[model samples]
Target: MLPDFRVRQRDYLLEIARLLTEELDLEKLLARILKIAIEMLAGQAGLIALKETEGWRVATAHNIPPAFLSYLTPLLAEEKVADLDVTELNRMLKELTYTASMGLLNGTGIALAAHGQVIGVIFIFRNYADLFSANDKALLGSFAGQAAVAVHNARLYGQVNIEKQRLDALLDSAADGILILNADLTIERVNDAFERIFGRTHDQLAGTPHAEVIRWARDPIGVPLEEAITDGWPLTPNATLY
Candidate 1:
């Protein structure tokens, strides 16, 4: 039969795989990974630090009391991990361990990397010395890889959301009465200009058929603009006040 330690190790590996696949939000994923790390390795606390445009920020933490969090906030503010060389990283780790007031904490840290770029760091902390084994280090490293992918995905999602908002603002600012139509010629979006020109509210006009909208706006010449629109022609060459 396999050794009990080997069986436990397999279980831990399986759990890690499940955590990586199941969690999509980076913050929640990091929290779940840290909780697992603490439980599997007998660590007291864990912290995840991510690289931002400004500096390194704590993305997640587990089992750390509010008091410790308060103390750590200022120390981590605008902390640029990207600027640190290996020597600097080592020195910082040593200093943190030495100055930590909670207890004699033995900690392991691994950098989160993707596409050959370091994105963040994962740290596992314990109250006793020599708590981290070679196996623990290897496992944490693998977990970091998964964390990097999740963080990258989160950043990309955030960027996409920002761009969408910008595009929406641009559309709203357009002076012309712009209407977005689907394949069925149903209205999707009507801007402020549309509301003013058509004398209709967004709530009243949205989702209405394009043909119906054109019928509603009968021109001074009694021409149905819907016919021109459906024929792919301009309604008027010059601006008409009405």
Candidate 2:
């Protein structure tokens, strides 16, 4: 049989893998990861604080008292995990509670990075005297590794949605009929004007070959832009549609 710690690590990693496969929502994914962290470590309370250009914001919170939220936010802001001291932490807690509320004061922080740069940190905390073992840190780091990629992909997905909306608006407001083609010379988008002019539904033309759509026109030109250019006329794929 495997060691107890190894078994626990396997369980945690399995959960982390499950998190990676879920729907692409950055906030929800962060919350789920923090929840798993607390469950794996028996943490009483924890929160995920993400770094924004404006400042730090709480992405998710679990079992963390509102009072503690204000205190914990600034503590992790200017400092990394290495800089935190348990004795000093409890000393600060002394003012808030009658006695030492924190027993062990453990935190595992993982730096989330994208494109070779530091983006944010994932922090898990517990209020017990027992220190986190090497195994615990390793598992937490692995969790962060996968979490970073998911978060990055979610961000890109959001950016794509925004760009799509802008492109749609531009196409809708344009004076002339406009159509865009994919690199493979297939119709990607056709505006309202294009549909009206062509007397066909835009949805019908999507994914259809640009050449085929133009072939249906009155003049019946096979290729509108068929010039194997001589000089630097901005190289494009053999012009299937003008």
Residues 123-177, candidate 1: write the lDDT tens digits: 7778877756787777666666766776677667678888988877898899988
- Computed on alpha carbons, the lDDT of every model, listed in order, comes to 0.71, 0.67
Model 2 error, position 87 (Å): 16
Worst 10 residues of 1 by lDDT: 233-242
Provide TM-scores for the models.
0.67, 0.71
Clashing residue pairs, backbone N/CA/C < 3 A, model 1:
none
Give per-residue lDDT, candidate 1, residue 72.
61
Worst 10 residues of 2 by lDDT: 224-233
After TM-score superposition, the amount by which residue 76's alpha carbon in candidate 2 deviates from its true location, in angstroms, is 8.5
- Model 2 agreement with the true structure over 156-198: per-residue lDDT tens digits: 7778989999999999888788989886678999998898899
Clashes of each: 0, 2
Model 2 clashing residue pairs (backbone):
104-128, 104-129
Model 2 lDDT at residue 6: 79
